[model samples]
Target: MRSRPKEPRVPPDRRETVRHEIVSLLTGESMTAREISGQVGIGEKEVLEHLGHIRTALRSRLVVTPPACLECGFSFRKRERLGKPGRCPVCRSERIVDPSYTID
Candidate 1:
C-alpha cells in the first residue's frame, strides 16, 4: 500500500477565518447564538463553539449576558455554558431567554 502525501498547514496570518467577522458583528450589539448563526451562516451549535474560543481569544472583550428563566424570573448568572439552558431549575419551565453576547 502506498502512503498519501500530507497537506501543507496553513500559515496563521494567511488563513481567512470567520472569527474576525464574528468579532465585528459582536462589536456593539448583543445577539444570541441563534442570531449569530443566522448572520454568519453557521449552525447555532457551531456558533456556541466559536464563542468558547472567542471568549478566550478576546479575553474581557467578549461579554456574555447570562440566560434567564422567563416563567420564574430566575437568572442563570453563574452558568458558564454558552448555549441556552434546557429548562429552568426553579420552576421547571422551558421558557428561558437565550444568553446574549457582545464585544466590549
Candidate 2:
C-alpha cells in the first residue's frame, strides 16, 4: 500500500501572515474563530492568539461588526474584547459570529 505524504509544516512567520490575510477578509463580515482557523490552515487557539496581535495592530481602528444571536436576534454591542460569547443574554443561544478586522 502506498503511504500518504506528510504535509509541510507552516513556519510561524508565514502563519502570522496567513492570519493577517484572514483578518483582512474578515473585516467585511463577521466569522467564527473556527472559520478563521480553517482559512489560515491552523488551530482555533492559534487563530485566537493571532487575533490578539491583530487587535493590537489595529488598535483604535478595530471595527467589530457585533455578533447577533441567530436564535434570539440579540446583538452584542458593548460586551467586551473579541472572543466567543458564552451565551446570548436574550435566549441563551450559543450560536454567534464574533467580530474581526484588519488594517485598511
Candidate 3:
C-alpha cells in the first residue's frame, strides 16, 4: 500500500500575512482571482470570501479594478465585489481580466 503525502500546515498569522500580501499586490495592478488563488495556494472561491473580509477590515477603502469590456467599454461594477464575470453585459465578451482590490 502506498501512503499519501501529508498536507502542509499553515498558521493563522501566516495566513493573514499572505492575505495582506495579496491586498498589497492589488494596490496598483489588477490580478485575476484565479491568479490570486494560485499564488495563495487556495481555491478561487476561497479567495472571494477572503476578499470580503479583507474589504471590511480595510473599511471599504478597497480599490477594485474590475474587468472592462473592450468592445463597449463596459465595466463590471455591479459584479465587482466578488469574482470575475463570465461575460460582459454590454459587449458580451467572455474575455475578462480578474479585478484587483486593495486597502488604502
User: Top model by TM-score, which number?
Assistant: 1
Model 2 agreement with the true structure over 32-76: per-residue lDDT tens digits: 777778777788777777777777777756565677788878888
List residue ranges in candidate 1 displaced over 4 A. Answer: 1-16
Ranking by TM-score: 1, 3, 2
Q: All candidates: CA RMSD in angstroms?
A: 5.5, 4.4, 3.6
Full ranking by lDDT = 1, 3, 2
Worst 10 residues of 2 by lDDT: 11-20
lDDT on C-alpha atoms for all candidate structures:
0.88, 0.71, 0.74
| Candidate 1: tens digits of C-alpha lDDT, residues 1-104 | 99899999774452347777788889999999888889887789888888999999987789999999988899999988889999999999999999999999
Q: Write the per-residue lDDT of candidate 3 for residues 28-98, one digit (tens) a residue.
A: 66677788888777788988898888887888777677777776778877674577778887778887666
Residue pair clashes in candidate 1? none
Q: Give the better candidate number (1 or 2) by TM-score.
A: 1
TM-score, one value per model? 0.83, 0.63, 0.66
* CA deviation > 4 Å runs, candidate 3: 1-21, 24-30
